[model samples]
Target: MSTTVAEVPDAHGPTPAGSDGEELPTRPTPRRSTLGQRMRREWQMHVFILPGVLFFSLFAYIPLLGNVVAFQDFSAFRGIFGSQWVGLQNFANLFTDDEVLRAVANTLIISLLQIAFVFPAPIILALFLNSLIGERIKRVIQTIVYLPHFISWVIVIAIWQKVLGGAGPVAELLDLLGMHGVNIMTDPDTFKVLVVSQVIWKDIGWGTIIFFAAIAAIPTELYESAATDGAGSWRRMWHITLPGLVPVISLLLILTVGNLLTVGFEQLQLQQPAVGADAAQVLDTFVYFRGIAGGDWGLSAAAGLLKGVIATLLVIAANRIAKRLGTGGIF
Candidate 1:
């Protein structure tokens, strides 16, 4: 009789207890690790990351626990642990508070203006810069434009105040011409426009860097191929350059949406004295007034938390829309 080795069963396979079959020892999965092994393998990377992890834990994570105060009537004397639970009282008050509502309205208005105007300025500036042939002139222009971004908001505000104030160069020039001086800094009607203009003037140059880098990254082969196909400069820019910028544009838009409410506390705070809270108050400055100045810690914390949650949702929705439209996402 010819018995085939293929008919033989392994010890790990099905076996009858009464047949004197021995149990096979199980082996660990190739990818499975004991905790000690994993720690030993990743220890170097963990060591490298420890400081950053510690800093975030200390500064960010630890402070997050204080958000519980938002749900309570927080008192400095009673401490966070001992506070009385208020259950939406702070949030309720936020809607009813005139200053808070005004701040919310002003914030939304300024943010929309920024989205419409400031967002496009950099890309346009970048395209202009990219088209310039002289490298030396390009570098000089880039340096001059980027200089404003490094200037402190205080100095920027001071300069603007000096220029647009009743006695500054612009106003002085108007005075010499026997024309009425425009006090734009204190005009509530033009506050949103002024803020948007300031954002463009201050950060537009620095913002161009990302778009310029994106423009530079476009393969020369694409433009060469387009040229071979009889495409003009305008056609190349329309077909290739703009499309190349879409990813960066989408990313920045999503980030901007996420940070819509965070229009620089110091900038508005400095301007508020001139424009008054009604005109200059945004959500950030509102938080500062309530939390730091007014000492209504719970109310301010709730407002801030709400704003953050809204911003996060906006970013997520924007990313989803971008992905559906066939653009690269932040993820």
Candidate 2:
């Protein structure tokens, strides 16, 4: 009649049966806390995002409900509730509308230009900057370039107008060289090029920050190995640096495609009058004119909705293509 002791099993695993022909008791499993309990415990952290949540709910997500106006023959006086439901009439008109079609075409052209020129500008700049040996020179160059990104689109346009306009330095240089009246700012044929150039100048440095980070993340060992294997600077960069940037490049490309129709609302609207609808007039400007100026709110909403859907579809398609091509997508 020796005293008996209850042997508890280890928390990690159950133990074998004891000599007394009874299994050891296991430690009790921990119970999961309820959502309410977790929230209460993490209330302080939640407080930080409370304002952003409220702001988006009020200004972003909640207003999405107004998209219903796309279907209704909406009027300011009659209101969404009182407006007549015209079903798909507004959407149908979008395909038949010349203005909408023109906007779509221009948007597509500008989007292609941006992807070709603007998207890669940053990657090249980052590589060039990363190749620089002087940290001081690199810092100064980065500061100067990134400063333009903070400037307003209005100022950016103004700067470009001064440099490329009829009386700008470039025009004066052309005038001196017997190529008089070579103004690009007002030239419709070159307007798309101007837009793409402006985007590159402004955001290239900002975009490079990500690429520089990606390059930094590449293992120095790979570069050393490549160098030891008789690889030159270009060879190492091509094999190591370029591959490291693929994931980031693919992700940003997907996001850029999603905004395919956007093409900078402020930037395009400010230049549309100068270039006219033929060379400018993106989808955003079309919506502005139709909705606010022309008072065709329903048709405008329909066009807006249509563009949004197209952008969304493009993002999905681009992401799938990226994934299939072996680079990871944003999703």
Candidate 3:
């Protein structure tokens, strides 16, 4: 009889059947979980943020629905649901109103002045404080400066009036010296200066806290190395300190541009009567006087809506520009 030869299978050959001649099924790959399933799995993590989410939904987002008033001839009597739709009539009127135009102009000018002068005050103060050698003196100065920020606007205005008002100490001293005291409080030409100065004085120190923190984060080794290499104080600040601060400066610049139309409402409103509306009216004051006080609810709502839209656009544009310049932005 001839000997029978069994054939051997290659490594890449198809899977063999079992001894009983049955093929086993291959295991299926796992699929990703759906969003709902993921949310369920992470439910506990989300619970921590639930209160904040609810708060914003209630106060910030839900109230946005009220912007419908901008498109309607809104009436207090008829209410939001019952108001007659007027399309763009309110917005048309807003653009045509001379007082509204003037308010926009004043708002722009004051915002520009603040950006140019007041915005940098805090940075300068932070730099000065950071340069100090004594931590105790730095803490004391910081406390004194930050105190003004916590004071109420009413008290702040009152303090300003006492110091610079027509019959205040400066005026009294000027009278004794037979010299004319400058009327800073009521002068339209000087109102811009006064407002910017007040902002710097009130918030400069508080604003510096962030900058101080940024400066402190810089490694002392870098400064010591720079000094060892014969680099002067100004050179180190220019090369390292300012470069480190560029990201922060860029972020703040974008925010400042976004708020270019919103100079302090309370500050402007408090002093408006003293200097007259022509000198002090801003978008906020315009909304208050035209809407709440004057009862032209729809028109004022249109103005406010416009301001918000412009601010949003400004933020978007500024972020884009910052990105182009290679500075990271606040998204």
Candidate 4:
């Protein structure tokens, strides 16, 4: 055949591996750094947390050793080391003590009321605040609500006393209306209600901060799409916003449950003189009155230890329940 011009590979065509008579080298894998090396590299971060560690050790953790006094006939003169170990006698005494039992009942009652009423106050307020159309009005209202949180409880109690005490305006108005003025601050029958109300007013604004942040994190697109699909303000909030807040709400609820036995000591202590111990006594006040004020150190410690154990157990149970319900808890 008149030789057809032999087909030839283009000069720039792909070449097979080793076709050029050279082998490509493989890359070496990187080695992982040792723990020591990692620690050295992140040493600055360790330094930053060191002060917090020291502070907690000094003020929080180290003091835990004092809980041992619960089992001892502890004396200030003999000290923790030299004290007589009375075992569970102190605990037995706690169960038998009417004051302790009453304190427990009062604590549970107040805590339950707070959990039911005060806990939801912030959620409702945050939702209401977020729905405001005017930014200036919303901000002004937020400032007013937030101011009470910063004021000391002393001032807060005083303010409430001035507003609800027998000679206060509401009381005066009631008196003028034919119903005699009553001192709400000192009323045993309604002390629990007053406590819950004070707590709601004081912390609701501050508590809403987390919920508001949660609301902000929700994708704006969800609300816009919902609106485009004919959803109203309440519908958008109910469907989109409320679901976004479940996590924060669950976390706070679990924490609140954990603190069931520990009511506000200073708050109750201050009002106890006016309302009497039967209405105002709680676990915290029980401990204070028994241990420091009454010099029943062992009994106080036992009550404290029991409170701590129950709180820890409550946290664990709440965490488990939250996990089962599909909202993660603050473990």
Return the TM-score for each candidate structure: 0.88, 0.92, 0.89, 0.90
- Over 4 Å off in model 3, which ranges? 1-31
Order the candidates by lDDT, highest first — what do you get? 4, 2, 3, 1
User: What are the per-model numbers of colliding residue pairs?
Assistant: 0, 0, 0, 0
Candidate 1 overall lDDT versus native: 0.89
What lDDT is obtained when candidate 4 is compared to the true structure? 0.92
Q: Cα lDDT of model 2 overall?
A: 0.92
**lDDT for residue 100 in candidate 2, whole number 0-100:** 88
Arranged by TM-score with the best first, the candidates are 2, 4, 3, 1
Off-target runs (Cα >4 Å) in candidate 4 are 1-34
| Model 1, residue 6: C-alpha shift (Å) | 19
Model 1, span 101-185: residue lDDT tens: 9899989888889899999999998998888889999999999989999999999998998888887888778878888867878
Please report the candidate that would top TM-score against the real structure: 2
Candidate 2 C-alpha lDDT tens digits along 1-331: 8998987778766567779989978679999999999999999989999999999999999998999999999998899999999999999998898988999999999999998999999999999998888999999999999999999999999999999899999999999999988989889998988899999999998999999989999999999999999999888889899999999999999999899888898998899888888889888999999999988999999988888898899999999999999998888
lDDT tens digits, residues 1-331, model 3?
A: 9999898877878677778989766668899999999889999978988999999999999999999999999899999999999999998998789999999999999999999998889888888887788999999999999999999889999999998888899777877888786767888988988999999999998999888878878888989999999998889888888888888889999999999999899999999999999999989999999899998999999999999999999999999999999998897
Q: List the residue pairs that clash in candidate 4.
A: none
Cα lDDT for residue 32, model 3? 96
